[model samples]
Target: MLIGHAIFSYFPIIKGWELLVAQFNRIDPEFFWMLAAGFLAQLVDGALGMGYGVISTTILLSTGLNPAAISGSIHTAEMFSSGASGFSHYRFGNVNKKLFRTLLIPGVIGAITGAALLFYLGEKNAGWVRPALSVYTMLLGIRILVNAFRKKTASRKVKNAGWLAGAGGFLDSFGGGGWGPLVTSTLISKGRTPRFVIGTVSLTEFFVTLGSALTFFILLGVSHIETIAGLIIGGVIAAPLAARMAGKLKTRSMMIGVGALVIISSLRALVKFAASFF
Candidate 1:
């Protein structure tokens, strides 16, 4: 099932990875390449609700694209990925409109501000945000993992959890992949109902990513249309299926697995960032 999602949503990303491999015989790239990376990242993102921005932006930046461009494109691609998931949640009546409305404005503001900064960083060779992302995601992953092993667990979706959502959006825009896991986990933690938390998180992902994508295209043009189209197709095909599967998943186990995977990924990223300096 996980492999299915990976294959479905991440086909484009895998394609991009192969290209990088072809060029260098591995995953390493000399610069940013949006088409393959962004598309594939979103595929996995749609399937898993995380890793889209982080992996795509990281790989894209390797392909020689400026930080700004990679950031823009990653943000842009997320719109489609998040939209599909968000719509599904809304359809299922999982969305808490009252809480969502309260959170939307702040979420949007934080995203816009972060996106503006992301563009600037995308143009440079800095890895400043990467480590921060790595650390935060790693910690969240650990926390969830701990929660998963607990015998008596309390998972409630709270109405007053907007601050975490807003903060997660801002950090995700800056650090990457913080949106879904971070916010979803926080909601799960603060005694929010599971159904509403999942729904609210998914819907918020749609809006947050949709807004970011718009900013990217409007501000920075997409040079590779075909690649972008491929990503579009992949996302369209993967989102609904993933949502269906997500609905069937036992939330607790899924959270633990997701948390574990993210932690592994974040550790890898953190190590890489540390290595860069040496």
Candidate 2:
């Protein structure tokens, strides 16, 4: 529990030596669970290019963690995880540099705006944010499922970069997940090449996540150090492997996997919320 309290404090700012010491100095059972969550989430996200946020956030929410804090912790840790994923995608020739640049700036802007909104909204009414996010995630999941059955066509260049990336970033920041679900699903459904879309989106996530996390830290202040650290450690371990697997996966399979996960987790969360009203 105390470890949970120490999970997400300015980790990137900490000296490498300090981080190394903290890892060894604070050995707690709870921290290991956090690490495991991170590892599993990152592995899924890496392989499928989505899931870190939905999976991790779902678990934390079920455990009764604060919604804002969970989002904060996820974005903070994602700063590192997305970076690793992006690097792997880049190395594997998955990214389209031109498309990456087009999406990056808008995504960052939307993420920052969304983070600020979430912080303010959550402070005023935390209850609203969690359930709302759960519903939104569920809807996105359903969209993916519909997309999975759609016929593939010849790859075409993506248009409306501003709208798509901005919306994805906003949804991602506000809901604490959705970059892949919203962006990847939509683009792939529109006939964008899966390999490039996954790679570009994965890489752009680093920026979107970084901006959102920074906004959260600025407004909400740092929190959940143990949880964040555990997630970061686990994600780091899994990211490279996930990146390697991304190119190998079929796009339809990836959509099905992501959609199923999102639907299940979101349904569970929503059901819990509905029960709370009863």
Best by lDDT: 2
Tens digit of lDDT per residue, candidate 1, span 183-271?
76566555455456666767778777766666666667676444355445555566666566556667676666567767878898888
Candidate 1 has an lDDT of 0.65
State candidate 2's TM-score: 0.79
Q: How close to the true structure is residue 3 of candidate 2, measured as C-alpha lDDT?
A: 62
TM-scores of all candidate predictions against the true structure: 0.74, 0.79
Candidate 2's error at 69, in angstroms? 2.1
Lowest lDDT 10-residue stretch of candidate 2? 4-13
True-vs-predicted CA distance for residue 28, candidate 1, Å: 20
Q: How accurate locally is residue 15 in candidate 1, as Cα lDDT from 0 to 100?
A: 86
Per-residue lDDT for 3-100 in model 2, tens only?
65466453443575688988777787768888889999988887766778878886777667877778888899989988988999899888989988
- CA lDDT of each prediction against the hidden true structure: 0.65, 0.79
